[model samples]
Target: MTGQLRAAIYARFSTDMQRDASIEDQIRSCREYAARQGLKVVETYSDRAVSGASLMRSGMQKLLRDGRSGLFDVVISEGLDRLSRNQADIAQIYQSLLFAEVMIETVSEGAISEMHIGLKGTMNALFLKDLAVKTHRGLKGRALAGKSAGGLTYGYSAVHQITPNGDPIRGDRTINNGEAAVVRRIFQDYAKGISPKKIAEALNVEGIPGPQGGEWGASTIHGNRERGTGIINNSAYIGRQIWNRLRYVKDPATGKRVSRLNPESDWVITEVPDLRIIDDALWEKVRTRQGALKSKETGVPVWDRRRPRTLFSGLMECGCCGAGFSKVQKDSFGCSAARNKGKAICTNMTTIKQKDLEARVLDALAHHLMDPEAVTAFCEAYTAERNRLASAATSTRTTLEKDLATTKRDHGKLVDAIIAGVPADQVKDKMIALDARRKELEGQLAQADSSAAPVRLHPKMSETYRERVAALIRGLADSEGMEEAREAIRGLIEKIVLTPRADGSGLTVDLHGALASLLLLATGAPVHRIARMAAGGQNDKSSAGAELQGVDMIDKSVLVAGAGFEPAAFRL
Candidate 1:
């Protein structure tokens, strides 16, 4: 690589949040940075109205590709926060720069600053999260207000109802087109017992582009392929329209609005005088056909036999045979008897008790997942140490610069003295000493400036760590009135392997999931003792369960180093 440095500047702003004029502010920052380093501002990149959550932006991808081609020795951004809202994506970019020997710099924070990388990427990721919440909130509000929250459906187009000047752009009040025809056709197909997948195929065969002007998706065809701008639950395809079938009301406890499709008893029938799309008797016959076929496929209601429920049933499989092990009991979840009875043909019947074993697993989770306060403490500790190293590095860099300047002057002096007829050996010795000193100083500077990365959790992030631990704990401690929370945890811990005790006693469970197992160490709990469930299959008595004790584990910072969680993942 050439000794002279070159860099590219990347500036990005969301047009949704800031004015287009703000682009100039970023350009100014890049110019000033280039001037400071005496490096060429060979390229400037910007993405407008584009999220920093991904490099999906066309301009941003081009900037990265140019960097990969070794067009520049460095990439500078206004700040690391502007580069990405995702820490993972930021890390990917940082690693990719290694291929070209490219350094990353930001204004205020100069080249190859490792400490700022973590801090800035985290800030950007949080910003992205906030933006997502804001967008979701707005969409939810519009949905509640019966305003369009999605793209124009299959039969409808989104056109301006009011102009920028607040002028009526349609029919003074509004204009409704006869999109009614397209909607009727879709419902007619559904009523004719055509599957949604089949309907999609038919539409594709007819070369009909969906609402997004792309190939049809089942959900797209279902949600928007309705016959009219009126309520989507129009029963006209079933020979009648039921007014007020689905009711919207605010939930009493949460104060959040929810929708419920009401029973037929509550529906009000109304006959529409609009252009008839299909004969009522034909539509009624199609509806009956559809319902009968659906009932048969789903199994008739009365004949639906209830199956015994178990937490890990059908999920736990033998490591050898890989056949799912059915739960024999809450305390002893074991492999299926059919496979086990056949001896070496399959796998051993490993069984584990449910109680004590669960506690040890929870304890492990508590330790590894780390409370937010503890994480914050660790991070604070790590951050302080990093700053100290950076200070030492900066001091060494300053000293190197002085040494380089003095070496250049000494070289000149040695040459001049030789020309003035000083002994050749003396001049040569002096030059050698200066060169050695210069090399030593250069080595010291490189050693100092090279990255001593901070105590980074990296892929083992605080948020994900907290989530995984909390989930495992909740799954084991599925207390009364916590059904939803339990299910969430079950999804996280895909499976648990139980090994029978050496003496043919209850089993010892080794919880997998790399992150989940790590949490066990964090809590300082290693082993669990499992006890059999009662005959009723509810749970064992006398044994205790692990509880969060009202601390919302969700918001606890696994990286923070203190206790007492309040609401959100904030440090104490």
Candidate 2:
């Protein structure tokens, strides 16, 4: 309609398993299409692993904003579906662009008219509905057959290999023994009335990664209550497969996805007792406690919302039982597990005076970080220990590099063999096997490289590190902004596990992450030695518990201290 058409490109993919290159491919096609139409491509926007049904996507929003600003006369995409699969969302997007006098051109559909938008949008929407129906039907069938219907769960791995006929063989959820042990531990701990937050802390301290191979969150372990979903509420743990408990529906107004609870009658419950991870008694205990907590939360007054309790609200955990320490009474923090189920349920029954805990934490921060002598001592010890770890990891790195290179070479050879006319079927199997090995080796090498890299002190460590750390501490400490302070603490400390002294004298402050590194630096203490000192070696899992205790206070503090702390074992 105007001079050389200025076009903007939009591309998206719904899931990460879809190659990231899908976005690039879509953009490439759109550019080619624009070139053919004598259009000048001005800008390109892409949202990877984002659903088309949701306009909450950053790229989509930016495209809309730019369209409104009259930055482009034409918007180009690979297809109408790339813009949106939801009929309402597509109509809205088309109208918004049309109102701005911007025209949409899809590579497949050419220029979009009002009729094209109406018909194509409806068709895309219908296609999505049909896909959902087919997916649900297949999942329901799988559930009936006692097979997993979705992604791999925490304790189980999906059997991924296809059958000879190319049909994916189902009903093959194999329990990962290593992860299963952690699952059992979670059930046991929860049954004993240990809070999810504490359990997460214990797992982190023991260097046991969660489902996503990262630090665990309470939500990840406890799950959502409305849907009766999550690792804690999953009926799969009780030897039953519950399908269709929740559905994600796109909101017409916002073009965003919202999760809705499905009716019980609609849920397809399947019996698979052999698949159960938690025992009946443990499941019952956890369920009962969860029900009680839900009731408590439901009755809480609006004014008594949980967020305002303290600066260290979610960061504190019961050192003994690994349950979260929550604000029990005014100016006091106590283990939620102990408060809910009594001291009989949890041994960490002592309530910490909030002011006292806060003071000690701040003091520890100043003493270990702000003092010039302490900073020098910490820097020296930190650098020495880092060098030692780097030396130890050198051999491991070399071995992994060799393994990766060999696997890649073998993969290249297999590819060449296939090109040279081996039986395609036989060669295909070998290629798959070789590719899998190559991926595994590459992963190992990548991990090795990351771990082997030394955590170095800032260049200003000798001259200005102390002043910088002190200023950072003061900025957080002097601020009345609870959110800012909380955020700073989160960045500095991985966790603060509070162990009530068995002698009833006081609480032992165990630091973790960067905090531990800083302390090790200041004290020139070995990891286990400091951990023992912090934990007082009072409980079972003495070494682990002790290490956990010592590690609690410091966590990500190394980063805060301007002396980076990697969670290397041999801390000075």
Candidate 3:
């Protein structure tokens, strides 16, 4: 009644658990606890029906932001499980609050960080790990059980079924009569030589709302032109569901990254009795044409980008939208979607020849970065450095884990004594002191694992011997392939900014950030300027420049020796 209190309460429930449990109940419990402690209650945060395991939780992000801003001195929750079901997520949030000097009070668990409290924290972390696994298992089971585990797909609906004994159940259904009619027309139209945009326009002209009740876009039209799902390419119009045309996998290890062509054993198929979107013959024609179209103009296949090709799509970044530019000619490239809709979003389209940019970039990387031998040496050095730190990290983690275990055992004894009617103030002081020590140990353990022992590598050129220096420089100059180039680029050069380096009219290379970071750092020398630098005493820029390295490292200005080289048309 006398003073104001500021508290933020957080609650979460994953997708599996019926519905998100009561935030009101959590808040009420928190409010009562705050009242008992004569503390004020200020703000509340809730993420209704969102997984705590997800990295992009907006509710948790907002809570951390407000907490760091000092809008709340304390955060109350039902338990650690409600706040997060992921250990890493919980740890990150815990660190945020600890750094911001906020107190975390759990109504049921009391305060944090006694040997017992810390043990409970570990248990809470374990609970989340187990919860994430359990939730995934349940979902996979539901999906395997021929249930609609997710939303109604673009062309299908949920149907009711009855067993032979007459009990009813919900089942995944066939294409909707209305949507199926639309699907057949789209495939037939495409095979008859209609473009995707034309198909989209025709659909819009007829006023068919797209899958989600929006005006049809090219992407929507393109995506729905699939086969076998009977949504797009139903081989079944001639009567058959090609049950397993394609499959995909979501790998959990790397955050559920999708992979194509999961094995046939993984598919589930139930044929519709009297439904078909497109006939087998038409499906075959569409598939053949689509394959041909793709082979003619290839994109980077969905594989690892560890070995980057000098593809125009990889090198050219749009100055306006920051999207990578796509190739227009074998010589030059422009934006893929710059003026997508009547020059609407972006009207500016810039093009640059491939050979001109590639040569200079390769040379610049060579001059700045180390080559293959140096990278191998560096990798060896880096591995040793990491192992040294890893050893120390392991040692420190082991000690804290032991301490945490001991503290938990002690906490159990304290709880038992309290429950048996121990005196309040006497037991309370001991619990608080134990909690504080546990928290301090935790801080030390976190700091050790985070910043850890330093990697020993002298940045000073003088400290490095002449052999090492030669190896380093030569590594950049003679890096045999793209991997060495990329390594040297990542290590020495900060960023490679591309612009019209020759008098702002022609393209050239500039390595700025890491060049400055690594002194003896290589900087760009546009041909006009380099010629002047080379002429020793002559003003080469006024008269333009002369060819030196030909098209290998210098621009056409240098290749032509004051006369621009004849532009050659390259067949892609």
lDDT of 1 at 343: 41
Tell me the tens digit of each residue's lDDT in model 1 across 268-324: 554433423556665565446534643455564211323245544443555555555
Error of 2 at 396 (Å): 66
Model-by-model lDDT, in order? 0.53, 0.68, 0.53
Against the hidden true structure, what lDDT does model 1 obtain?
0.53
Q: Stretches of candidate 3 above 4 Å error?
A: 1-6, 13-21, 65-71, 95-101, 112-147, 157-182, 189-262, 273-275, 290-308, 311-315, 319-322, 338-350, 358-482, 490-572
Better of 1 and 2 by lDDT: 2
Q: Write the per-residue lDDT of candidate 3 for residues 1-572, one digit (tens) a residue.
A: 55566778876665644354577777788888889877777888877777655545677779899998989888888887666655555666676786566877888777654343456557866876686578556655555555544455555666878989987664456668887777777778767777555666666666787778855544554443332332334444443433333544434343343536546665545444455566678777777655544433454221211223442234345555454455556667665445221133333455677766655554544333433344344335445656765785788678787876786678678878988998766688777766765776677777666555433433233223223334544554554643443333333322333443335564444432221212222222222233223233222222221221111111211111111221221111
lDDT of 3 at 534: 24
**lDDT string, candidate 2, 307-406, tens digits:** 5546566768787888888887888888876654344446677787888887777655544433454455555755676666667568767776776688
Using Cα atoms with residue i matched to residue i, what is each candidate's TM-score against the true structure?
0.39, 0.52, 0.55
The lDDT-based order of candidates, best leading, equals 2, 1, 3
User: lDDT (0-100) at residue 2 of candidate 1?
Assistant: 56
